[model samples]
Target chain A: MTAALIWIFLPFTAAIGLWAWSRHPAQSTRLATLLCLFLATTAWLIPIGKVLRLGPLTLEIQPILLLAGRRLNLTDTDRPLLIFFFTIAAFWFAGAQQAGSHRLFIPYGLAIVSFLVAAMAVEPLLYSALMIEIAVLLSVPLLFPPGERSVGPGLLRYLIFQTLAMPFILLAGWALDGVQANPTDTNLIALASLFLSLGFAFWLAIFPFYTWVPLLAGETHPYAVGFLYLLLSTTSLLLGVEFINAYGWLRNAPQLYLFLRWMGAIMVITAGIWSAFQHNVGRLFGYALIIETGFSLLAISLNSRLGVEIFTMLFLPRVIGFGLWALSSSILLQAGRSMEFQQLERVAEKWPFASTGLIVACLSLAGLPLLAHFPVRLVLLEQVARQSPLLAVWVLGGNIGFLMSTFRLLAVVTGGYFGPRQPGERPLQITLLSIGALSLVIIGLLPRLFLPMFTGLLSAFTRLP
Target chain B: MTLANLLLLPLLLVTISTLIILISQNWRYSVLALALQYVGVFWLINGLWPLGLAVVKLVAGWMACAVLSASQPAADVREEQTSPTAPAFRLLAAALALALVVSVEPSVEARIPVNRFILMGGLLLISVGWLHLGITTRPIRVIIGLLTVLSGFEILYAAVETSILIAGLQAAVTLGLALVGAYLIAAPTMEETP
Candidate 1:
């Protein structure tokens, strides 16, 4: 058995099967959650290319699966990636039904996860662009859903920017090949770098291109958008890290890291400032994610072992914060049928768990003390401060803007005349939100225990500092 | 036809079809133009890729056109109504795109070994396609614009890469884009949000 077959193709087939069963969303959710958890467990336990003894039967799972003259390779190092992807998949899927996500979400979400895994597993990683494009297309239905009256410009723009990124990345791959052939060719190197930057900028939705993030967030179900952003952001960030690790020139270029630092700071500042003015909780969710992405970029900008470690560590808090935010916002949106701050009066008094979840998520994203993002954000900002105190202040200014928005939300949710509460939030939702909020604080307080686990992620990028 | 004129045929087809797609409001006409544009793409790619592989682009493009065409009659009611000046505006935009393509062609050509006609055709389609996106908020038009952009990139990339895997994956992406476009058009008509 090949590791690629087990980790990539098997789940893809299961996703297709699950689509047939998506008519029963609850059952499909359960099945998908179990399948993803099982996959994650296998990734954690099994070693690719190593002998395994099952009683009298001995077996070795190969790393490569060949299809139509191409390869899907998953080595022992890749097991960490598999574990991460499937674990995140399980996390999202487990909460999907409770969040009132669309019925098709379970099946299509699994398909997206499978495609992203294929993107990671594919040889000549440039092909991941096409894989990501397929995933983006799959996400359209999730965003638009059925019976939606009128399509939003945000969704269309999301599709456009993502699709546009594909060609530039593919073309960049070809140029990099040229660079490989003629290492000292300055022109080829410059062209390749430009293409890669533009491609990733669109994919990651850096500053100017990020207009779609808030738009899509405002229009779609928060649960689906959360899943979409979480998977896309994580995959793109890993892919960017892989590029740096693979290319000596990219890693060695001080300009690339400098560009990353400035862009990271810029994204954080812009997203944070925008968040401060937003009255919509859903839009706030989008801005919060943008700030997280900005911090991730800053982490990479540090260009050291600590930087890479912080980058990976950021994911745990992000997943919990975003997950809680998406779930709580979804529950609240379903209750009120609107995400506008003015419309959701006394929401905290009405549904305390969901409201607290929202507040905790925003605070965590703002890097509040004793929240999930604090320790890593502290170290990253310290490193950035050491390099350039001015950039660190700008980043802090962005965080302050975001914190203002969070405070605004806190005020809105806490005040307003009390109305009769209707049996509060669902039990499952309360359980999930409570667990998620607790995890954030726990991770923040005991950073050493949870943060080191992400260090395993750095194993996949051995060449990085 | 002389060899020079024959080689230029694809570029002419591509330029005209891209302009037609940009200017035409009729979904049918735009779809037809898109198919013709793909024919031009296939022809340009034939010079670089094997005939068998080049056919994949035509087939995928035609399939995408078919998917999009099948989705339109119900969505016809929602199509944007353009002013009389809109077509002229689009033409002016196309003209600007052509100028940009002409100016950048030399620099682009310098960095890689590519046919001059092919390079011009690719750049023109991408430029016009982006113009199409800039002008339209409608899902179908944006998708067509994206397809055009991808087709343009494919023509240039065909010169640099020849892996069947890339070709197949690109074809799949084309079909996926079309399917998603069709879904967006038909989404409002479904019974409930799924």
Candidate 2:
């Protein structure tokens, strides 16, 4: 058996099966969640290229699955990525039932995750662009589920921007071939870099290209959109690092990291400034996501080992914050609230657990003290400060702007209500929110303990540093 | 006819088809223009790839059109109207895009070696398709625009890369985009979510 078969193909098969069974939403989601958990556990436990002995029968999982002149290779180093994608998939699928998402959510979610893994594992990583496009296409129905009356411009723009990236990356790959043959060709280098930059910019939704983020969030189910953005950004960021790591010229180019620093700072400040003025919690969450992405870029742009570590460390808090925020937002949405600050006034009185979840998620993302994002964000800013204090100040200004919005959200939700307080959230949702809120605090208080677990993620990019 | 003349026909075909798709308000004509554009794409690709491989683009493109035509709701047919001046403005934009392509074709060719006709056709479709995307908000039109843009890229890319896996995957993406377009069109008619 190959690692690709187990991790990539198996989940894909299960996704197909789940699609057929999706009419039974409850059973399908339960099975999907369990399946993803099992995959996650296997990814965590079983080492690829190692033998497993089952009472006189020994089996080895190979790294490569050869298919029609191409390969989907997942080595021992790929275990962490498998675990990361599947664990998040499990987390999201587990909440599908309570979120009142589309019935196809679990099935399509599994398929999308499988495609993303395929994007990573596929040989000649340029194919990853096409795989990502497929994932984007699969997400369309999830975002605009069949029967929904309005087709938001956000989804359409998302589709167009992502689709446009494929040709650029593919063309970039072709140019890189020329550079590989003649590494000193400056024109080739310039061409390859331009196409690659444009490709990733579209994928990452960098500024001037990020208008769709808020629009999609405002229109779609918060839970599903959250999952899509989280998965896309994580994969895109890693893909980008992989590209830099694979090419010596790219890694050595001083201008690349310089560009990243400016772009990262711009995304941070712009998203933060926009978030401060936003009325819709959904849109605010979108801006928060953009800020998180911006910080991730800043971490990588630091171009030091410490910066890379901070980048890797940021993932845990990001997932926690977005997950909690999405769950809270979904709960409020299913309750028929519009997610506007005006509509959310006194919401804490009705659904205290969800309200608190939303508040904590936002504050944590804003890098509040003793919150999940604070330590890494603090280090990231300090490194930026050492590089250029003015850049650090700009990053800080952005964070402060987002923090102001979070405080405003807190005020909106916590305002006066005369009625006797009664919990509107279901017990299961309450339990989930409580767990998520506590996780944010726990991870925040002891980041060193929890964050180190994800260090293995960098081991795959051996050449990056 | 000389090989150059043979190639020029398909080039002209794609240019005219894309222009028609851009200017036509009728979905039927737009769809027809798209199918013809794929035929032009196939003709251009056949120069580089085996006839068998080139046929995939044609078949997939036609199937994409079929899916889109079948799935478009009646409401969309009624609502696909545009201002009387929009097409005229689009036609002017197409002419400008063509002028830009003609002026820049040599430099682009220098950057990545390909035939002049293929380059011109690819650039024209890409430019017009991009303009189509910018001007339209409807899902069907957006998909058509994206398909046009991709079709342009594929024509140029076929001259450079010839991996069968990429070919198959690209075809799959074309069909997948079509299916998504259909889904977006039909989404409103389904029963409301619980």
Candidate 3:
């Protein structure tokens, strides 16, 4: 089997097999965790396109496979990215065992991950638009799984916006055809810029386009939405970088970079302000994600290697921070029927570990000191401060929205000093929560340990390197 | 009317029907209009692909409408009841949509080598589709709007590039949109929750 096909088929086939095996959520969960871990390990360890022998069986895994006349190419440089994708998948899949969701969470989750990987690998790469649309479609069932089904406003909005992005990207690719050779083609440049920005804006859920984020988080299961949100943003970021690398004019466009910065600041401030008033923890998590995107956009706006480094480094913290946050929310959801602030009054006493996980995850996402996200946030804000102190101050000020929620989440869980304390928390919850918390602190204190892994990421895109 | 306007019959049908679906509350009329819109799209796709491909476009669109129709409840108020101002709003949007298409179609026709009616049809569908999506909160209407928007892009793209790969991709996208609509239609209502 070719490298590309194997990566795509493993999850795609597993999704079908696991679903057919038994629509039981528990079995699907176990298989999904195992499959994700195996994929992650393979992605990390195996050399792409290397020939292998197992007695009489000889396998030469070609890096590219053609499907319907289009090439699906898997390169050596893609290994790190593939590893990142699978590892993040494994994290979510493993966490899914405790995070209450539909039976399809495991199966559909794998399929979505596979589709996203295929999107990154597909050549003529505009085809990635189709792949993303397919992934978005797969997300629909997850949003309104079997039995409990609300005609979620979030789901419809998500579908409409995501579908809208596909044509813009595809047409932009067509428009960019000869523009490189003809840089003087002002009209083409303008068209490409407009389409690409609109496409990315919808894909990344930037600003006003991001209403679906909080809405979905408020209504649907947190784990599923979190996974989809993180996957879409990461893939979109990769595509954005690819655009910069491909178009010399776009690569050099300082105006676009400034626009990204201004927009990033706005997203940060807006999401922050909204997060501050959110009474729903689920919506709070959604706003934190927007804050993360804003910071990421800010990093890109720097238009320098430092910016690229910070952005690349974000892959790690983003996965861990969001994973922890989603996992905790899902756990708490299982503990209680609802997470409305009043509903959560002192419920943390019964689910101590979940509450603790929720607090740490929120703080981690908020870029609090001594958490997974702090190191990157610190460096990024410092860089911003160096370029424009007001921007730095603005970003810091926006984070206060998350900070305010953190305090509120803590208060809601604690229920004042007079509240009664419950007995022991669940063993499994305790273990996962402890691991998440410890990892966040370790990564926070030792960002260097993980930062090096991402340093090699841009090298994969040699155009930028 | 000029030859372009003569050729614009199918497009005009598509634009008028798209507006009907957007403003009308009856699920039955909306489905009929949606199917007709797809038929209009199929006709416009001519000269770009084989007769077989155009048939595929028509069939896929019809199937999407069928899926959505099957999922709807009998005697459903899938969208809000029409207000007097709604039609006025739609009329204003129709005018704006017309302006949007007129302003861009010429530049598009000049820059890209495409049939004039095809260009205008695609732009008109896209403009009206966006307006439809923007104004509605109902899931079914939203789905129809999405289908319309995609139809415009697909029609334009088929003209620009007609590979089997592109055709297959677009077909899958249609199916995906249909499935989402079906899912949303069958989902338990929000009012069911306390």
Error (Å) of candidate 3 at residue A284 is: 0.9
TM-scores of all predicted structures: 0.98, 0.98, 0.95
List the candidate numbers ranked by TM-score, top first: 2, 1, 3
Arrange candidates, best DockQ first: 1, 2, 3
lDDT of 1 at A191: 92
Ranked by lDDT, the better of candidates 2 and 3 is 2
Candidate 3 regions off by >4 Å?
A52-58, A418-425, B1-6, B77-79, B189-194
TM-score of 1: 0.98
Ranking by lDDT: 2, 1, 3
Q: Could you report the Cα RMSD, in angstroms, for every candidate shown? A: 1.5, 1.3, 2.6
Steric clash pairs (candidate 3): A149-B188
lDDT of 3 by residue, A75-191 (tens): 878888887888788888777777766677777888898999999889887889899999989887767776665576887788888989999999888877757768899988998
The list of candidate 1 runs beyond 4 A from truth reads A416-423, B1-5, B74-78
Question: How many clashing pairs does model 2 include?
Answer: 1
